[model samples]
Target: MESGKYIIVTGGAGFIGSHTVVSLLESGYSPIIIDDFRNSKKFILDRLEEITGKSIVSFDFDCSNQEKLREVFSTYEVHGIIHFAADKAVGESVLKPLKYYENNLQSLVSMLKISEEFSVTKFVFSSSCTVYGEPDQVPVDENAPIKYTASPYGYTKQVCERICADTAYASDHLRITLLRYFNPIGAHPSGLIGELPLGVPNNLVPFVTQTAIGIRQELTVFGDDYPTTDGTCIRDYIHVCDLADAHVRALESNSDEEVSIYNVGTGVGSTVLEVVNTFEEVNGVKVKHKIGPRREGDAAQVYADNKKITEALHWKAKYTLSDALKHAWNWQKNLDESR
Candidate 1:
């Protein structure tokens, strides 16, 4: 392990990034955070500091700004970088395809350029299971062929992976690992840092907890007519902390290949109704929910085949969906009490 190595976490103040920051710190890496606060907040830094017991080094700037990114590169002697700065909402990406393409691709391009310029060789990309695009097989593996993207959000991840592959192929200097994450939920378990999305929540756990807290009137099960066990979309929900730990393992991996991709998810698939019912039952709160029409572009079932990552990176999800939902509810209650 590269103990005390300086690692730059772009979007480190956001949902998954923040939890990864905690894991990085615990793993003995000095993580310098960079977030624009467009979809995140300054208050998260305080919570992060409280959890890690270290003063965070951060910059409030968009990573796509090449000039500012160059400044950050020159400012810190970075050993590696974990790029997570991208717009991730599927519905929003469908509504604003251009916005998704612009922000997501631009940031990746700038980061790649600056990483090369600064001689930062190791890169861990925050990819998504969306790249698989409603796989024909259950428990999608890393070797699964990339299908046509259902949404602009999925397209961004697909393009970014291609970009990383091409860039790595052209250069022997870069070592890239694309952690294709499934649905990541839950909090730090400290209730300090979690998914603090602005405005209306796009994810299921947040919407569920918010509705339980009375912040939202009711939860809408997006689709109930899909060809699934319960006629709703099924997803592999991995806990955020476990996902963060997987990032740590990815960074620590030693391989001869220039680029590696792993499916970061629990092997279990849970339907929307199951998630809602589990959250309510585990937290002892009834979620007011009504089944709505199936959302456009939603896959019927998509989970992970975790053999590669387990064998290669020595990482596997340790938390169950119920465990994740409990932590999510705990974080939501903390937010409610704080306000």
Candidate 2:
């Protein structure tokens, strides 16, 4: 048990960050949450306590504020950090590039500076597979050449990874691991927490779930002319729990390399149509959807070649696509009932 080893999770109240906090508690590590509630609700902190039976230690502030963040370091003997605070919306990024750049990059740089000052050694960065942009091939690996990103969101992730790598190179103590995630869907099976997007959802699963539950009138399949199995875009939709568990593994795993990179995903691609069909079949609900024009900054087909993370951190996605959709529907239903 890492009894008193306090790991700070920025954006800890958000969807993936909340789940990772649960994972951290289950693994016997004390996690302190830092969030601004810019894109998340405050009630999630209570849910975390409800799930874990532990009073969470948290601070409510944007991590980009260096002085406020420094206070956390001064108070607690911080052991490590898992940075997940960023404005993550591909389509929105195309519309508001400045918002993405300012919030995403500034938060990352602020966190990095705090880590350096506090001498927090182990760092896990929440990265995205969108860094690959429109890959030259399907099932892109960690070794794939990072081409020009399609959106400002992806550009921020790419730049953040570089910043972490360069920081690791300069520092003797900081060891950073960049986990490039593919699409993450599903909710906690307990239905206690899930992806709760504030406005219109930028991701497919939440929008699909909302459509099923009647919050959204219908779903829109972004593009049907892409060069893929069903002409719709394909993604590697791993369960959010599986993705959250990978963070714990990445934090626990040891390596001689200062900056390590891994692709955290199921090594398979499911088309947009497949996801919709599977959701209907598994949960006994139909999602009314139409073929809309292609969304900007979308890749034709992007999945993971996840052999490296499997071997290095002993991490592999456990939940199936059908299971993910089923859980997603259950979460949506749960939210509806609560309201």
Query: Which numbered prediction scores highest in lDDT against the true structure?
Result: 2
Q: Model 2 misses residue 10 by how many Å?
A: 0.2
Q: Write one digit per residue (lDDT tens) for candidate 2, span 199-309.
A: 999889999999988889989898899988789999999999999999899889878799999999999999999999999999988899999999866878999999999
Residue pairs in collision within model 1: none
Candidate 1 lDDT tens digits, 1-339: 233588999999999999999999999899989899888988999998899899888999999888988877777788889999999988899899999999999999999999888777899999999899879899889888999988999999999999999998888689999999999999988998889978898988899999999999999998788888888889999999999999899889888689999999999999999999899889999989998887777889999999999999889788999999999999999989988
RMSD value for candidate 2: 1.7
The TM-score measured for candidate 2 stands at 0.97
lDDT of 1 at 75: 70
Q: Compute the lDDT of residue 116 as modeled in candidate 1.
A: 83
Model 1, CA-based lDDT: 0.90
The reply for model 1, stretches above 4 Å from the true place, is: 1-4
Global Cα RMSD, each model = 1.9, 1.7
- The local distance difference test score of each candidate is 0.90, 0.91
